[model samples]
Target: MQLKTKSRLKFTIASLLIVIFAYILSNGLIIGDYQIKSLGSITKLGLDLKGGVYIEEEIKGENISKDTIDRTKELIELRVNALGVNESVVTVTQQNRIRIEIPGVYDAENALKQIGKTGKLTFRGPNNDIVITGEDIKDASVGVNQQTNQPVVQLKLNESGTKKFAEATAKYQGKVISIYMDEELVSAPVVKSVITTGEAIIEGSKDIEEAKRLAGIIKSGALPVELVPATVKTIGPSLGADAIPTSKKAAVIGITLVMLFMAIYYRIPGIIADLALAVYIMLTMLIFTTALKATLTLPGIAGLLLSVGMAVDANVLIFERIKEELKLGKSLRSAVDAGFNRALPSILDSNITTIIAGLVLMWLGAGQVKGFALTLVTGVVCSLFTAVTVTKFLLKNFVNSNWIENKKMYGA
Candidate 1:
């Protein structure tokens, strides 16, 4: 009797703690100035969810090489990052075009002005002769001047650039070598000495942020091929705002019905399954908000809902197996063990196959398809753990506690 009491106490405490943690994760906690954001707020929403602008730009010249297109895409991504847009995606698309998706950005014209510029960097002499181009730049980084403690951009040049720069410095030691980006004057630094080691520095940035921005632009290099904006469109946030609440309602209603059905039909085991399901939901959201940093989309929500159903289905299978074992005159503990053991193969086969399919979709698909695959795979994996491990552990503890040993409660 004492052992049973201890077991029940431990199980009750554990279950309560799990519930509290899940609640905290879903709704967050706040104490004074300290606050934890809920999973929904922490997880990033995709362009479809947050509503931003997408621009498709086509290469102007015909028969553009793959290398050129890839380079352009990379540069565009860097420029987008420089614009302080987080979670922007730059993808090479069909017909020698590249697509850029900037989420949470509403100013389409400003975004275009920042990312679509040619950014052709050049150093010109007194007579306006080109001394070096962006292609000659090997690297550019923001650094501080050790002597003055001021922000500056350090440049590393290629071999040809080094030779040309050395000549330019020698020819105009006390004269200004003006730097230009797409014909707009950026800087004019006087050549103090001939630099033969291929390294240079640009000073006079107003602050560290300005220095970093200039460095980022220079580091991205110029686009290899000219590009023209093929299409530009903006998605309004109102649409996403509407979809989010609807998705939440659907998930809540569906999960509630599943939980009610499980508790009604399966009794004790169903309640435990619902607890495990809660853990699964918390775990999935934790992954999306932290490890994966996944962007939630409408399709991703569908995947999440589908995986929730799968989790319940797994629990149902195990409960039915337990009922069969109970009918065979097995003891309660033996029936529980045998049920999980027997259901293991089927559970593994289904989850494994689904995971494989999700991986394939993630690999081959793009945009919303990829988002769906990511959430589906993550949710399915979490479900497998909760079903095979968490649910089994909880059920075993309840059985050992002997608090509710009635065969009817076990659905026998």
Candidate 2:
């Protein structure tokens, strides 16, 4: 074999290896304690599909400012995201009521308990002089006491908080400074001396776990207004289970048709396109399940499907251009190169516009809209990769191997 041919063969083998690795990850193979969770197990499903917790919380007080309501929503979003509920939506209704939907969670009561807390954390001296509030703290973390070997909550103060806390500690040395959560005293520890470093540790936690929990709540920040739970709803996984098979069937059928269309019309090029599309889907699923920590909702599926069409559309555009170039008397390699180059401007313009729209929807939209936007954006990005780089790579290898010198094989 020619050295060049041998190198091409090795490259093909490497490409196949990558595809196999991706397939295993997509299916989530577990080896001993180390496991790659399958896409179904790895990806969470949304409330509409999987049914978890739905909560309607009314903010107390009359005529709450929109700013406060917005702030509350942002805070709730942070809290849910922090709690690993990546797909949860926290939105404000016109009535200023907050609606929260979290999918795939089983412990509704515990979730509610943590989420419902006002988290109005405050640090106060023995004389009840406030040293700082949650807003003044830059960050909170859990640690172990070096001297007493007790679990502690460590707080890092902002500039203003540092000044105030230092003053409080200096003035109230040997007296207790109380840590309050939602106006209830959770701990009171004696101030040892002036804390000039802008850091304080609350050392009365029962254990490291408790200290960590407290730190998480504090990091979520306090709500501007107290929230009273008005209504709560829960859904089971039966809805998701029923929806999956139907969705899967539709997707399988649709992709199969796409695969057939490409292979029939574009011939060998279509087969290469099919392989690229397969890799695109695998990478997209891996990103959705693990990297984004996102759940699949019905609308998310729609987004994925729409993206599949867009991916196919991209390839169609490039293939048509390639055929046009070939008719214009360009060689297969030259036509392939020009096709990609000429098609990129159109492809980028379309995908960029869609991405812009998706971003807008993500910023202002809630629930299903957000899910759709996320999936659409993800799909468009992956499509760009497969349609451009992957397709180009495969075709280049095939051409380099001298496998198809026939003009008819180039869809001529």
Candidate 3:
């Protein structure tokens, strides 16, 4: 039984090492068109680390409700989207304020102009006559046309507003039904037919971009209240670009020191813990890039570093328990088992509380806080996996192989 368990444990370690190496090589070395694009792609960045324009729009008006703040947020989000800045952030701040962060964008002025307007969604007749106001519309979505390779914004009318839309479409079929945001003719769809139903398609054009912008505007819906720009601030990406190299250096130093400490303190079990930690790190990166689609910010890198400490702490706790058991004259094999079993409850209780804190941050925090919370949560989850399962599995195999029988090496 002992020999069988020992062989199985070694095989398991070897298999895990092979799988980890294969995963890394397959993702990094395979270079197709798609792979090449991915290679050039810097990981998605958050507002602080990537650095772009930061604009604050103060809400004005008497008796401004929570709903009004929410509406302003939605409208600002739409305008930010119209600016063609990808991965923008729009958040509602305290004291009736809205904050906008546009990441990795160069033309701050253009982006500012795009979002600085009083958002108005309008529908116009063929002769540029006003048909209906944005308040009449209920919902809008960007959709792909099955028949034609084009995008369209499908608008839904309010129940009471259906008659107005039907009448407008009846007179405007085969003519341009223009949708506007302030003076901009966002969508000019040629009406196909006149129907009483509330649905209408704002057709895409030779420029698919216009369709996308219109879609964002319509999808944002009408703001319940108007907003005036209170403040606008722009930060250059150059600053973020400078900080990234520093973050990378910190990550390297942090990981290297942790690995060295583990090996020096715990000997064989410490070595196993280090190996598991490596696996933990690799898996965390893979999940961040491929699963959660997280943007790695400087704070996010800091969260990763913190998690490395937590992972090491978990191992230290378990190893210390083993040492205590050995001091009580327990056998090497029994000491290892009792150590894990005894330390587990405390380990679980501590990390579970931290995980709860992470969940709260994810709920209430936006932008960088969200990124930091997400990375920390992922790290906690992966640490539990590595410390509890991976380390235990490795130690079980090592002990069964009769590799280290001395209680001194176990740090008794």
Number of the top-ranking candidate, with lDDT as the measure: 1
User: Candidates ranked by lDDT, best first?
Assistant: 1, 2, 3
Over 198-296, each residue of candidate 1 has an lDDT whose tens digit, in order, gives: 998988899997787667656656776777888999998888899999999999999999999999999999999999999999998899779987778
Model 2 alpha-carbon miss at residue 180, Å:
11
lDDT tens digits, residues 1-412, model 2?
8845974895588579667876786576877899776677767777988778888888899877775676577656655655677668777876668988888677778777867766677778877878788878898888988889999988899998899888888899999988776555657888887898988787778888778666765665677688888978888888888988999999999899999999999997898888888888888888888798787899999999889878878888898999999999998889989988999999999989999999999988877888999999999999998898888888777877776788778787
Between prediction 1 and prediction 2, the one with superior TM-score is 1
lDDT of each: 0.86, 0.82, 0.77
On TM-score, who's better, 1 or 3?
1
Name the runs in model 1 displaced over 4 angstroms. Answer: 1-6, 60-70, 94-96, 120-156, 159-220
Model 3 / residue 263 / CA error / Å: 0.8
- Candidate 3: pairs in clash: none
- Count of clashing pairs, candidate 1: 0
The estimated TM-scores of all candidates read 0.76, 0.72, 0.72
